[model samples]
Target: MHRYANPSRFIRIADTIFPWAGGIMITAFAIGLYLALLKSPADYQQSEMVRIMYIHVPAAWMALFTYAFMALSSAAVLIWKHPIALLSAKAAAPIGASFTVICLATGSLWGKPMWGTWWVWDARLTSVLILLFLYLGYIALINAFDETERGGKAASLLALVGAVNLPIIKYSVDWWNTLHQPASVFRLDGPAIHPDMLWPLIIMAIAFKMFLLTTLVTRIKSELIAARVQNVQRSLHGNLADGRG
Candidate 1:
């Protein structure tokens, strides 16, 4: 793990894996969309409106999963000081933030027809909303300092602190009486969703996961390149100062 922390090594690995991940993401999304939008039957209750689930559910799941990834990476950086872990967390923040916004926006779109409202202050929705703020907050904090290291460390701390919200978002339905639906796929009694709907949802979820991985690698590559450029400039300046001295 530490050996791969070297930027060159990390870039080499990312270069190898990113193309494959991107290809798989594109393929999976194509198949998943076909299964979700074309092949799957409309819900007996919600009809065509349920089609929103294909996009909304996966975005919502990725919202939580991406934060978990960031929090864990932040923890690794704080505890073990792994530069790659920190860079990975930094790379993931914006992507996670975008997904969180999509989840909320799509949820509202789905909700208006079914619930007769565009938004509600339900427990599940509120927790997920807070999750969005957390992402933005992390991003803001990361850019708040003149020293990039200071900003990164401060943002990492915030990410770890905000992680407590993940479980709250997950169990909001169980813990509070809310408009949001309870767990259908992850219940102790087993999944409540039918196979026709379930398979497409699973496929979409996997596609979303791959999509995040694809973007994360790209972002990390950019970060590594930028860092290398900064280091080269700093070294040149230091040598010039020594020569003048």
Candidate 2:
């Protein structure tokens, strides 16, 4: 991992993954949407409205997955001091936040019709909301310092601390009586959903995962290039100061 920390090498690897990720994401989304929107049967209970799960569930999954990825990256930065780890965490924050917003918004939309409200302070809902705040807070804390290293370290530490919330969010539906349904898609016995709906949901999840890969690679490369340019600018300024003296 440290060997690939070289910006040029990492960019080369990213270039390879970018096109492939984009292609898979597009293809998966096309199939996933076709099945989810047109082919799958309407739920007996929620009817056509349950189709929203195709989007909402995948977004919710990605929200949690992205945060877990960030937490792991933060751990790398703090323990092994992986040069690219902080950059990866920084790159992922906004994407994860976007997923969280989608989850919350879709949940509210689904809730209004199903649960008779636009919002609720239920355990799962509240925990996921806190996850959004964690992402936003991490972003704010990182930018608060002029020194990038200091900011990254501080944010990394915050990410580590915030990780405790992940498990809480995952189990909130079971841990307490919440309006949210308990695990159905991922259960020890097996998925509770029928095959017609399950297939589309799985494909949509693949699309979302590919989307993350594509965006993360692009953002990390951008971060590396920006850092390189900043280094060059600082060097030039230092040289000018010495020449003047």
Candidate 3:
């Protein structure tokens, strides 16, 4: 596993996995959307408005998952000094931020119909909004320094620290009387959702994971290429200076 930390080796592996993951993502998305939008029954309570769950729930799940990935990569950077750790962690920020925005936007959309308001400072929603801010902060901090290593280290540390918020986001509803629904599908006893609706939601969840993987690998590839270009240009400039001296 550690051997794959070599950037060249990692890129080689990413190249091979990229296409298969992308194809799977597309297929899963098509099927999931069919089930979510067409086959699934409307909620007895929320009626057609429940369809928003397909998008909103998945976005929220992926947002949490991506941040967890970043936190783990940050741990690898700080503890093992893993070569690809910072890059992988850095690459995840924008993607995570995008999903967080989706979660917030969709939640607001859902709220207007269900809760009669477009916005609220409820525990779960507020925490998730904070998650968005955290992602933005991480992106900004990563690009704040002149040196890549310095910026990477600072961003890595921030990721680790921000992980504390994840649990807060997850349990905020349970711990408080928030308008946000508690865990229905992930309960310890069993899923509260019916099999008919549950299947599409599960498939959509898988689709979101596949999509995140596809984007993450592509972003990391770009980061690696940019690093190589910077190194080559520095070497060329140093050689030309030596010749002039």
- TM-score, each model? 0.96, 0.98, 0.98
Per-prediction CA RMSD (Å): 1.3, 0.9, 1.0
Give the per-residue Cα lDDT of candidate 1 at 31. 89
lDDT, each prediction: 0.91, 0.95, 0.91
TM-score, prediction 2? 0.98
* RMSD (CA, angstroms), candidate 2: 0.9
lDDT for predicted candidate 1 compared with the true structure: 0.91
- Where's the lowest-lDDT run of ten residues in candidate 3? 145-154
Can you rank all candidates by lDDT, best first? 2, 3, 1
Residue range 188-222, candidate 2, lDDT tens digits:
99999999999999999999999999999999999
- List, residue by residue over 79-174, the lDDT tens digit for candidate 3: 988868888989988999999999999999999989999998999999999999989999999899866688888888889999999999999989
Q: Write the per-residue lDDT of candidate 1 for residues 1-245, one digit (tens) a residue.
A: 68878998888888998989888888889989999989999999999988899889899999999999999999988999888887899899999999999999999998998999999999999999999999999989987876557788889999999999999999999999999889898889999988989988998998899899889999999988988888899999999999999
Count clashing pairs, candidate 2.
0
